[model samples]
Target: MDSMKNKIKLLAVTHHDKKNINPIRPEASQIIGLHRSGEVDVLVLCNPGSILIPYFEKEGIEVLTDPLEKKLSISTVLNIRKLIKNRDVDVLHLFNNIACSNGATAAIGTRCKVIAYRGQTGNVSRWDPSCYLVMLHPRLNKIICVAKAVENDLRKYLWGDKSRATTVYKGHDQSWYQNESADLSDLPIHDDSFKISLVANLRPRKGLHVLMDALALMPEGINIDVLLVGADSNNEKIKEMIQRSTIPKRVHAMGYREDAPEVAAASDVIILPTTKREGLCRAVLEANSYGVPAIVSDTGGNAELVENGISGIVVEPGNPKELADAIVQLYKDRAQCKEFGVNAKRRAVTKFNVEQGVDATIKIYKELTK
Candidate 1:
């Protein structure tokens, strides 16, 4: 075992911009935890004035801003190389595909071990040269998948090595779920209406349209209301769909609520009927932490987080009928919902807590550094 005195000097890189007030990704929280625990001397490399900068700085962690481009730019590579050389970075932790490629290139001649964090289950196009460069890079020593499902997907690729890659579920700060006095007074909800919440970015892959389709197919006399809480990605398409739908009055498009935990608390059941697989569904985890059972599609890490018919129901992806059936079933049986909620909360607290994630990640860092 490495001595605590010889902490690893880690450089965590992310391509995410500072668009929102708070850090949206799990990497930020993990870095903050690592720094505070004295497990790693952490420095974050991100875009200029990135939303992450303020958050990292508030925690007294150092941040470096660089224009990390998606394409293979010489300047980006050289800058990263310089940072690695000057800082004596023991490990380069990359959070995105582009950053992984650039960091791998930069670490070519250095002793720094490259660790790529794969958080999405989307398969890389075989024709994309950059994907090959990033995934199969000789400099990359470890691939940290956010879920077992993601790791399985990576193994299908030519460059993915089962021996080198491992799953590490992203953890959440339990504090985010500790909103006992959460008030959803702002949302439109009647005392008699059953609320179903879908908290994700309003995008095609998130399967908002599929969820809406399920709602349209919902059996009559269900008396259900849906709260769509996320940033609008497809303009007013969702709104327009709601307006023209059979239950327009029952659906509320609450765009990008910062109080997501509170929103989950207010809802009876949470759902994520995504068509595409995710690295892991953080929304589902958050809802589970708040003791809200979810109905997620059997895609990506959704099934991993939600034990089908146990913690929550797992319906087939892109199937409106199945989604609708699951929703209706859960709605009809309140006891099952309560039981699932209890199990979900137990799993979230016991297995998916931020402390557990940090400990796993720190162990990986120690293994690499040693």
Candidate 2:
């Protein structure tokens, strides 16, 4: 235990700007809090031109910009050398692919420990494969997989050092669920009708189209509104898909929102109809914490978070009719929804709270340093 007093300095590396990025805010806050509380000394490394560099600096955390971006250099080796010399960072904690590549390089020459976080089940495309990443950094002391499915994928695809891989279920802000009562009118979809929400990036993997198909196939007229929340319209594929869908006026496309808990509280059901490949989604936990049961795809870690016919209903991935039937079934049975919602809250409190996640991370750090 005395070794824990070494007071190791940590460098959190990510692709997005820590200060202004909404999705990464929870992770940034938790890591910063861990540092502020004397568990670790922390620094942040991100793209040079990020908007939130000053924000991280204001929080008393040192910020490092990718020198390559600033100098307009293409040589990664020189850039990494510059980073090591400038930051004098002791350990590298990577979040994104770019961060892992650069930070891993810096760690090699220096006496810095490398810990990479693989938050998703797989890469967005072949260009960003997580398994390939594990192959790139053999000395990565730990690889934090958000789901068991992700861990399995890493084992099969990358065949990474199994001894180093650890599954830490994504955590959520518990205090957001504790109070419970809040205004629903300001929410994206707040009609007196039953509201269902699917909080995910407007991407194919999210399977929003399948949800829309399911909603359209419902036999009886159900008074319900579906709220879809996310950003990243770079592809505009989702926008095109939504425009072509023949669903009624009940389905709402609400863009990126920072107040996710409030949005979850306003909705009656949380739906995650992923096509395939997902980490333990934080949105489902957020919704479940607010006593909103989820209708999630059974793939990846969705089943791990949601107990079938217990906390939430699990439908086959990409099955629109099955998803629709499950939604309609839950809608018809208010008693079941309430029961599942209560159980969901209990599960979230027990397994997915931020404190528990931070504690688990701290324990891992202690074990490593020991």
List CA RMSD, all candidates: 2.7, 4.3
Where does candidate 2 stray beyond 4 Å?
1-5, 17-22, 48-59, 67-90, 124-135, 176-192, 200-202, 231-246
Clashing pairs counted in every model? 1, 0
- lDDT per residue for candidate 2 within 216-250, as digits (tens), equals 68766667877777733444765655554455466
Error of 1 at 329 (Å): 1.5
lDDT of candidates 1 onward, in order: 0.81, 0.72
Score every model by TM-score.
Answer: 0.90, 0.81
Give the range of the ten consecutive residues with the poorest summed lDDT in model 1. 17-26
Ten residues in sequence with the least summed lDDT for candidate 2: 68-77
